[model samples]
Target: MQSITLKKPAPFEKYNQPVGDRYIDVLDGVRAVLVLLVGAFHIWQQSWLTPHFTLFGQRYSLDFLLRSGYIWVDGLILLSGFLLYLPYARAEMGKMPPVGPFLLKRFLRIWPSYALNVILFFFLAVEKYNGNGAYMAKDLVTHLTFTHTFFYDTYYGSPINGGLWTVGVEWWFYLLFPLLGRCYKKKPMLTALGMMTCAFVFRAYVSTLTDTRMWFNQLPAFLDVYALGFIGADAFVALRGKLLQSGKKEKRLFSLICLLCVILLVYIAKAQASSSGQEGIRLGQMAHRFPLALCLLVLMISACFASAGVRFVLGNRVMRFLSAISFQFYMYHQVLCVQIRERRLIPSVSETPNRDSEWPWQPVFTLCSFLLPILLGAILTYGFEKPIIRYFEKMRSRKKK
Candidate 1:
């Protein structure tokens, strides 16, 4: 197996260090923010709370923002692309990341807790299973192998959980990233353009289809987002020298630029969400991902080079801690939120359910949705995932000896 030995860089020597040698704490913050958006969006679906304020004699509500949370998922995908390619972003880098170690680490990162959690969910809540035994078996098989996104039944009618479709997409990205990374390393612009063009073609094909949902939800459809991420990583590495050398004036400019990029992203999202029908919605999502990814990258790179205040707001200990367990949190939250709705945990005067009404039970449901998954995610992160990874590392060490 490929060893876990990374090129060590001194924390203080930012300029002299290898681009991928050190941890980027801000990325954790980014992931944390995206995860929170996703969680809140899901919670909002249940609570039906349209958080709004009166500004300049106009009422602005976040209902549109919550409705467009899929864009945030695109951001997360791009961030993953940015992160994985950072090691290769440096032009002087010679050795490639080993395939075995990369796959091994990715596997350990995902499957251990995933398997454990899903298995528990399956057995403990067998009563909640949606279909017959055969159907449920098929779903379980597909989910465990990370191939559930390919099918209609499992992807749409997940008997156990549908929240993991993104995980399936991410696993495919992981498998393809090494090849894509090598191509990007050899020819950055060409490789990126090729990936984007391929994704564009795929989206175009999906748009032509009658039921675009199944086709649009696959990994191939999001190649442009990943390509943008790779480009972002490359650009950030190229710009780090200038960033580190920036004065107060430059930092202030960067902060302003980042803020503007965020505003543009909001505008684009609102405009894209204007489509009426289901088909139009799918088309708009496919059509608008590129621009959204572009905006996200701009914000990402700018935030990295922005003022200390911007960096602090975006990159702090709390954010990093949340991010550390973000995957588990993201994975478990849907079930937990559904449970909150299903079990009627929060008090409601509605005839049927809380989601059926507009009264703000946001506080109770939001806390349960965010806090419970976080607690579970933290426990799984420390209790299961870390131990599995450390065990593999220890085994690798002994083998080397």
Candidate 2:
């Protein structure tokens, strides 16, 4: 079994330690923001297709932004890779024995929360469907094993836990991390950059040859997003080192450049989406997204290095709390939104043709659905996730002793 070699805390005292300490907290804020955005976009999105806002019978479609909201998921995916890789990058420099315990730790952290959500969703769905044991059983099994993405034919569109599909990709990313980490052990920065580049190239080549909207092609292309994030984590650490060496003016200049890069990348992503059609919604998935994601990452790095204001907000208790719950919110939201729409608990007069009896379940519902899940997820996160995590930590501590 691989033992995690705990890296001793760095002795560098000149650089701001608070920023480093609260880096994950900042990420949590970003995570919260993204989750809320996704939820809000999902809420009003169903009618967004043929948008109508009426005040005394004058109606107009307002669908422009909502349609594009799907890209947020890609952003979320990229963020996942970055955050997941951050810890591993920061861990003990020396090698662990093997991958076994490392993988087990990860599995334990994620699965408890995940399995609870699945069981909850299944029972709720079963209650609604009434004794359709086969369907519920199938969903429960697939979800528990994290193989829902593989069973495209049996339940392609069925969203037991709507946001969970990305998790399938996430698990794969984790499994591959040891190999990715090994490459970085030799030359951390370059390896990160190279992996990011290779991922982009792989996706770009595959995307052109095969229709990315197809499950066969699209599923694998996601690796690019994950890799980009993992690379971003490495790059951020390197940039921090450089900033520590440079003067304050240089750090500020670096931040300014990062800001400009972010703007340029956003513009490019928007431009690409315009050219690509609906599948183009997730602009981040396209190779064009690498620059934008990179820019955002750099901006974050710059904030860590140069800006106290950014640091304060990022490390603020409220923001951290929201961010902590964001993951739980993300995992359980889609189905809740769907249930709300299906029951017509939330009214919408606007019609979506060929989807009769099913109100256009807006993508914004994806956003709105996040709330209840956040609430429920928090309960689960604390009551379940916290305990499980602490249990592992305790076990590790005992082993060390």
Candidate 3:
């Protein structure tokens, strides 16, 4: 079995480490922001209060902000691609680890907690199989194996957890990473563009199909977003020297340019959203997502070379702690949200007599939805996930010895 030599740490490694380092505090900050956006979006979607207010004579609902939060999932996917590709990129400079151990590491990192969630939700939430026995068996098999995303027929939507569909998408990406890494190492720009092109073509073709919902769940639809992340990691490694050598003025100007690109991308997405017809919506999403992905890449790159003020803000202790437990939070939040909604724990719009009133109950419901999941996530992460990971790590170390 082939094994890579793990490189010794540089003296200044703590100052500016690579993507797969033990800690990238800024990234934890990024995760904090992403997870909060996701949690807030979910809470706002289920809440009864309509938070509408006027800005510059234009009426906007807070729900619009919540709806836009879904875009952060793309950011999350991008981060995954960046981190996953980093080690392979490093290995290319030396030797690659045996494929079995690499794959095992990925499986162990994700599957234990995921299995727990599957079992919990199966007993607590999933409906009994009342459909055709054959189809039910197919759905169960696909869902269990994290291959549900590929099928158009069985379990097009998530069978167990709505948020878990991303797991299926990400698991495939993990499976494909070795091959993708080789192409990326050979021709970084060409490979990135090719992946983006394939994503666009797939999304465009899927738009014409009757099963658009299933298409949306497919990995091909989001490949560009993931590709942008790969490209971002490449760019950072390639450009770090020049970026660090540049003056403050130059760095600020570059950051401004990136920010403008993001704003422009948002405007384009808004235009597409307002366009009439389903074709317009699908085509718009396909076209707009690429640029948005690029924008996210730019922001991540900028954060790496950001000024002290920016770094300090992103590297806060609380944000880092939240980031540490983010996976657990992501896995559990939706389940709790669904439970809260089903149990009628919160008042609905229909139940309220005075719609104009300050809606006191909404805050309480929102707090419960946000806090309860986080509390449970803390338990799952510290109580279960970390222990299992440590045990496996110790076993692997013993084998190495």
Clashes of each: 0, 14, 0
Off by over 4 Å in 3: 1-22, 48-61, 126-137, 152-159, 243-247, 254-258, 265-269, 272-283, 347-358
lDDT of each: 0.81, 0.63, 0.71
Backbone clashes, candidate 1: 0
lDDT by residue for model 2 (28-134), tens: 55666667756655654432333458888887543434444555666777787777667666666774336887788889878888887878776676665467677
In model 2, state the lDDT of residue 292: 52
| Cα TM-score per model | 0.91, 0.74, 0.83
The TM-score measured for candidate 1 stands at 0.91
Which of the predicted structures, 1 or 3, would earn the higher TM-score when compared with the native?
Answer: 1
187-256: candidate 1 lDDT, tens digit per residue: 8889999999999999999999998989886898989999999988888887886556677787788789
lDDT of 3 by residue, 29-84 (tens): 87788788877777766664557899999997654446555556777888888777
Whole-model lDDT for model 1 versus the true structure?
0.81
Candidate 1 residue runs with Cα over 4 Å from true position: 1-21, 91-93, 128-131, 353-360
True-structure lDDT of candidate 3: 0.71
